[model samples]
Target: MAWDLSVDLIKATVQLEQPVGDGSRTVGTGFLISDPTPGGKPRTILVTAAHVFEKMPAMSAKIGYRVQGKDGVWRFDPTTLKIRDGDHPLWVKHPTRDVAAMEVEAPPEFVKAAIPINYLAQDDTFNRYNLGPGDEMMALGFPRGLSANPAGFPILRAGRVASYPLAPATSFPTFLMDFSVFPGNSGGPVFMAEGARRRPGSNQTQEVQFVAGLLTQQVELSGERLEIGIVTHAKFIRETLALLDKLPGATVTQAKAGKTVKGDPPMPPATPAVAISATAMAASR
Candidate 1:
């Protein structure tokens, strides 16, 4: 069967939010990936921008999981996910990038909805697919904490590759996308859904669909929004997932005082509302 990234990935994407003491909630996006363990045990991994989880000071956040009833109606059913044990985070973060990953126990339907691990783009994916500036790509997220509908689905948006030199992922860890990015859009999947594209240096066309990266920040110059998003390469996501195994075990516990412990400092305060270059702002209500 032909793969449909829009539908396939939308099912895997979910909204993450937690209420700050001020009545407003900090919000972000996340998606599920089917990454089985080395022992071949089925596992689901939640992938998102590290700042998304970092900005949520509370130990638990709600994951918007929708349920479909027998009548074919989908209902929003959010569940609490433990993200911290007192002050320490439970998710693994990339050493330098904004990507983060953590193991999650999702409902059976969601497990099936998780995108395959192989769907993440590798270094060769861009060159092989002739992806470059001007190529169109799609992103899924809830901008400004707004969902697509009452069922709590993410909003899909499209944009073009705005920058050049998309390769290696060593020096250029991020690429630019010509899109209007807003808070709550961070951590969403940025992907290519081109059905068929001619391979580089060849007349043959191949169906190219893969996750390119995660939306990390929005670029701004002086105090104006540039409508351009910065996407961290998926390579860092893979690296962060690998770190999950090396790090000491951590678990989520019930919420306590809702105050952060002393030892673990909160993530640096978010960039100013207006940024000089870029703003790493996760959406807040």
Candidate 2:
């Protein structure tokens, strides 16, 4: 069966938010990936921009999940996800990129919704698919903290590649997309779903679909909105996921009175403990 990225990603993507203590909440986007352990134990990893977790000061954040009723209505069913312990972040980040990944215990339904790890583009995916400047791509995000509806599904948007030299992730870690980026759009996945595209140097066409990257930031100058988003290549995301295995016991360093100290490895906290009060939800708008 052919893969449909647009539909598959919508099921995997989710809204991540945390209360800012004041009236508003910090919002961002994230997607689920099915990356099993070496022993074949089922695992789910949440992938997002590192800055999303960095901006949330609280120890836990709400992951907006939705469920469809038998009556064909979708309802938002958010749950608290612990992102930090004390002052240390639980998610693993790429050494030199904006990508972040963390093991998550999602609902069984969501675990099935996760995209396979093979769907993420590698360093050679671009060349294999003949993807370059001007190629059309789609993105998913909760722009301005608003969902497609009250159900909390992310809004899907499309854009064209705006920059050149889309290869060799080492030399160019990020590329530009011609899209209107917003405050809550960070960490969303950017992907290409071409049913038929000519090969790099051949006349025959082939179906190509894969996640290209993650929207890390928007291009701006002099505080002006440029309608351009910077996307960190998916290669970095693959690398960050590997970090989870390499540093399973990694500790985050903390600064104590001008001195640096290594803290213990982060552990998952209790489930659904941090609830976003109904009053806080109304104030965020």
Index of the highest-lDDT prediction: 1
Clashes, model 2: 0
Q: Per-candidate TM vs. native?
A: 0.88, 0.86
| lDDT value, candidate 2, whole model | 0.78
What's the lDDT for residue 123 in model 1? 80
Clash pairs, candidate 2, are none
For candidate 2, write residues 115-217 as lDDT tens digits. 9999999999998877789999999987767678777788899999998899999998989888988877889999988888887789998888899999888
Q: Residue pairs in steric clash, candidate 1?
A: 184-283
Off by over 4 Å in 1: 248-285
Candidate 1 global CA lDDT score: 0.79
| Distance from true location, Cα of 61 in model 2, Å | 0.3
Poorest lDDT segment (10 consecutive residues) of candidate 2 = 276-285
Q: Write the per-residue lDDT of candidate 1 for residues 177-245, one digit (tens) a residue.
A: 999998888899999887778877888887888999999998867767789999999888888877866
lDDT of each: 0.79, 0.78
lDDT of 1 at 135: 93
